[model samples]
Target: MSASETTSRRQVGWGIVLMLGASVCYALMGVSVKIAGRDLPLLTLLLGRSAMLVVASFLLLKFRGSPARPGNPRLILGRSATGFVAMGFYYYAITQIPLANAVTLQFMSPLFVAFFSAKLLGERVGTTLLLCIVLAGIGATLVVAPDLSTFGGDSLFALAAAVLAGVAYVMVRELRKTDTPETIVFNFAVFSLVFSSPAVFLLDRVPTPVEFAALVGTGLFAFGGQILMTYSYRLLEVAFASVFSYSTVLFSALFGFVALGEQPTLLAALGAALIVGTGVIVSVAERVPPAP
Candidate 1:
């Protein structure tokens, strides 16, 4: 009835659409990683990704006239270090496991965030939060059931990526108080590039044109997804917008099926549902106001 209400609804609509687009971009990025990894070493792929991110993030900071240096160097470096290692684990998982399975396991970040936030941020974790964490743990186990018998499986890498990603996110929460997102991203990109550049000397062969394109696509799609997801949060509440992020799991499954001819087993499908459902509950619960 009111103009404000009408505008609010429209913004939410746009936010959902943008978030869905972001999910698709992320899924495509995973597919691209799989394609590129087939021909290149993991370190080579990381080098290419870091280079693209450095270029893209540098240009974005310049366009926004943001500072290149971080306000809190120690925290920024910690976040960047964790993020870089997590990315390496995630990329390795993508090459070794099914795309959907890898994405599902990595999505466990939010559950790990709960644990880290309680310990590091002094945030209280209630009964529901604890229960959600247990459910998510079980869900993750189911997703990786097939590989559990193998020591040091790729699924473990995905789970490790999730844990480190959670730590990086918690650090980002602290960094948000002092630095802009653009500055944080630029710093991380630079950190990744500087640390990963050594891989260039280790490369055994140059990538073919098709492999090169896939490597480039990995960064382009990931950056696009990050930009779109960030803007969507501006339009919608973080809790509501985050639900749309689970769509990335669905998109990854679809892309894996179509692009890579991969399919999820029945148990993995059930596990993915549990993880996505618990993730949505945890995200929404965190945003709810405490009872009076």
Candidate 2:
């Protein structure tokens, strides 16, 4: 292979690894949310998580000597606004639905990313890539099997979260053109903290010691996941990188089972299998240069 092609393959390889690492962190964050959701108000949980990110991102930028300001303030603000709202919907859905189900629903963001990346970023969406998206979508649907009566309002919130997340991911790709990952993350955390602060007064109960740990864990894990995801998306084509996001659904299923004592139905298990299988295919296929 040519040198550029070889470098592209390597980037794709590391992107897949980083995206999977992100999935693990995100899944763990969900576990923390599940544990703390009982006592924490939606806004309150967000407040703690955002606050943690603010501190973590600041330290990271300072340690690296990276600029804290985003290169494109407009794009950063738009990204943060969409992400903040998506998170609100996500927290509400997670509280109301099974953790795995809520995550699977939000997994729809990859489909949105694929389309938006193609339309907005002008990224290549060849036949193979489109098939990967379709396969992943099928897997996600099987995992969630969402129905009107069963999921109700939570389903609506989940869908809204997915749409908003889609927009946010597109903004990430856009920002990557001119901004460092730390800048994007720090700005997002700043916006989240500002937007979520007003909801702190809605706290239902003060958290116990264990609950406090869970709250902190949510922020820590989420920050790690966001950092990994930012780098992964920056390194790979948005469409290709997004296909690996299906890994989050698999991890969410595993965490939901162990932490929440939720058993996956046979169909859901099959769905998870489909998700993992497609992820492998996409990862391997991406290494090969597209026929010119």
Name the top lDDT candidate. Answer: 2
Please give, for residues 72-117, the per-residue lDDT of candidate 2 as tens digits.
9999999999999998899888888778778878878998998887
lDDT of 1 by residue, 1-292 (tens): 7986567667767776887898899889999999999868998888888888888988999999989989999999999999999999999998887676788778667667766766886666667657766676676556546655553477899889988987886776667667777888889888888988998899888789989999899888877776676556456534344445666766776788788887666776776688578756755554432111
- Write down the lDDT that model 2 would get: 0.85
lDDT, each prediction: 0.75, 0.85
TM accuracy, model 2: 0.94
- TM-score against truth, every candidate: 0.78, 0.94
Model 1 clashes, total count: 0
Total clashing pairs for each candidate: 0, 0
Error of 2 at 130 (Å): 1.1
Where is model 2 poorest over a 10-residue stretch in terms of lDDT?
Answer: 283-292
Where model 2 places Cα greater than 4 Å from the true spot, the runs are 146-149, 287-292
